[model samples]
Target: MRNLFFLCAFLLLAVACKSPEARRPVQRSSGSFIKESAERNKKLYKKEEAIINKIIAQNSDKDFESNPNGFWYFYNVKDTLSTVMPKYGDVVTFTYDVKNLEGTTIVSEKEIGLQQYQVDQSNQELISGIREGLKVMKEGETVTFLFPSYKAFGYYGIEEKLGANVPIQSTITLRSIESSEEN
Candidate 1:
């Protein structure tokens, strides 16, 4: 009887010690949502490209790069924001407000103050597109980049809350408020 009791206790303890990874719920719903979103985003992206191309062809003021993978446009500002580009390992801080093209607030840090993060560290610290976008900027420079869903969150929106058919295009306006001196 004592041996049986010990075996049960050992089994309980072993199970308790298992890492969270072992307990993670199977992400069937999220996986399916992502697959559907990717399909929808592809069609929307093509439409966006056509619209952008039409706009560019009609206007001479805007300069941009066009390609199937993604598009980037740069506008020269009258005031020089900053020249400091944070290096790969450096920590950078900034304040930002994200909105739709019509200026509907989707996210903002103005009420919350500045946000800080270390560049290039993946996973929880930063989104892949934000990481990629920051690498191209310098301190004090403000840039607005429109990212397709693949560059933003791929097929899965952050937290799987954003709908599959919801467009993936996001206009990210970034200001490099500060960077570590070592950067």
Candidate 2:
């Protein structure tokens, strides 16, 4: 009886291991999550662009140099010592003070101390604005950045150590970015 049972189980296993053509057809949806996410991001980006434009119109006197990545920057202290900007994978040390366009201080170098940032794709600590802004800054330069919400904080505002949401749809200014390169 045991031999007969083993023979039956062997037969079942043989039937199960069929050719690929015998397998059930895979039904892949025509719609994709990536396409949906991209569409949502585009709407958010457009909203941020409008908000930044209004802020720029309000402060017409300040020369805000805009970038393709949605951040506007201007040098407060243009030092010629380091004319070359740091590239990806370069280690840059800097002190930064970030504030909202309404002039509310979000965080400062005094509170967080100087930071050593590696210019790369995976560093979430640096916002899209700061990361892109760094590409234009040279060592010993103090640059002020005015970036849209999409570049600075996205839909969700930054959460501080004190657990306060800094709020969104607000343009942010990097009050000071004093960067120095390490040999």
Write model 2 residue lDDT over 52-120, tens digit each, in one string. Answer: 677778878777788876677667777667567766667677777677766567776587666677777
What lDDT score is found at residue 129 in candidate 2?
70
Compared with the true structure, what per-residue lDDT tens digits does model 1 show for residues 1-183?
A: 999999999999999998776566665455878899778767887876665556557656766554344745454331365556667667777655444333455555565356676776534455455666666666665555555555565455545345332223333334444445665
Model 2 CA deviation exceeding 4 Å by range: 1-17, 20-28, 80-82, 121-124, 160-183
TM-score for every candidate vs. truth?
0.54, 0.66
For model 1, the superposed segments whose C-alpha errors exceed 4 Å read 1-42, 51-62, 65-69, 76-83, 154-162, 165-183
Candidate with top lDDT is 2
**CA lDDT of each prediction against the hidden true structure:** 0.56, 0.65
